[model samples]
Target: MIRGEAYVPEEANDVWLSVIGKSLAYLCLKQAEQADPDRMSGVLAKVKFLMGLGLSQDDAAAAAGSTAQSVRVMKIRKRSSSGKKKKKRRTS
Candidate 1:
């Protein structure tokens, strides 16, 4: 399960938040279906956008409202998932 923080904006307006939040949530859900952290760039971008707007990481994640840990885990996973290919040396 994903774990992270979330925050709702105050002056962002209620109606606008609802609409955008739902959209982000939908995108996150779709990414989950794919089960690929690499594919979560969109969600991560949104989270970054929120953070850029002065929202804390936790609050920005919460605002996105779907995949929380992606903001955090996506980094780790992306790095760890890449590895050099190995070739077998046939034993004589």
Candidate 2:
């Protein structure tokens, strides 16, 4: 549905859809990692993004080799953080 050819039901559409979804998710995560190598959390963000795009949370987690429970936990932790900055110490 995202600027690609639509598959017909008789042609194993679900299989093709799942494949495309996983590939797109992987590409997104890879690009994010390239921008921030220290952040493994990018994968979880990718999963959530895919879910927002209509893929089931279970399918997204499966594509990432994780569980829905883990995804929810990560999301909760991410949101619970306060966007406050720590004071920087100056050294001569």
Candidate 3:
């Protein structure tokens, strides 16, 4: 199989590729968690990565071993803490 201009072995079919992708993703999740000494940061990293993979909040939370509510709260907090410009009050 051809992968991004590089030739891959014929054994690397769709099924095998999918399995490899999933395995790699799971390994990444573990690595992300272990990379950080902080537990919360690790969980957040997992959730963020899983969500980036197109999983919904609930699914991402589940895959990340966290609660959906926690994911929602994290998203809310992230939005609130972001550097968004606030509307300036008009002088009377």
Q: Which candidate is the best by TM-score?
A: 2
The candidate with the higher TM-score, 2 or 3, is: 2
Model 3 clash pairs are: none
Q: What shift in Å separates residue 18 of candidate 3 from its native position after superposition? A: 11
Give stretches of model 1 more than 4 Å off.
1-41, 79-92
> Which candidate tops lDDT?
2
- The TM-score that candidate 3 achieves is 0.48
Better candidate number, 1 or 3, judged by lDDT: 3
User: Model 1, range 1-92, lDDT digits (tens) per residue?
Assistant: 24675565676678787667656655655565478556445756657666665566776677666456666897567556777445789999
Worst 10 residues of 2 by lDDT: 37-46
Off by over 4 Å in 2: 1-11, 38-43, 76-92
TM-score for candidate 1, residues paired by index: 0.38
- CA RMSD, predictions in order: 14.5, 11.5, 7.6
lDDT of 2 by residue, 7-91 (tens): 5676697788778877887677668668866664566866765676567888778766788899888877776675655578999
**Candidate 1: residue pairs that collide:** 6-59, 6-62, 7-59
Q: Please give the TM-score that candidate 2 achieves against the real structure.
A: 0.48
RMSD of 2: 11.5
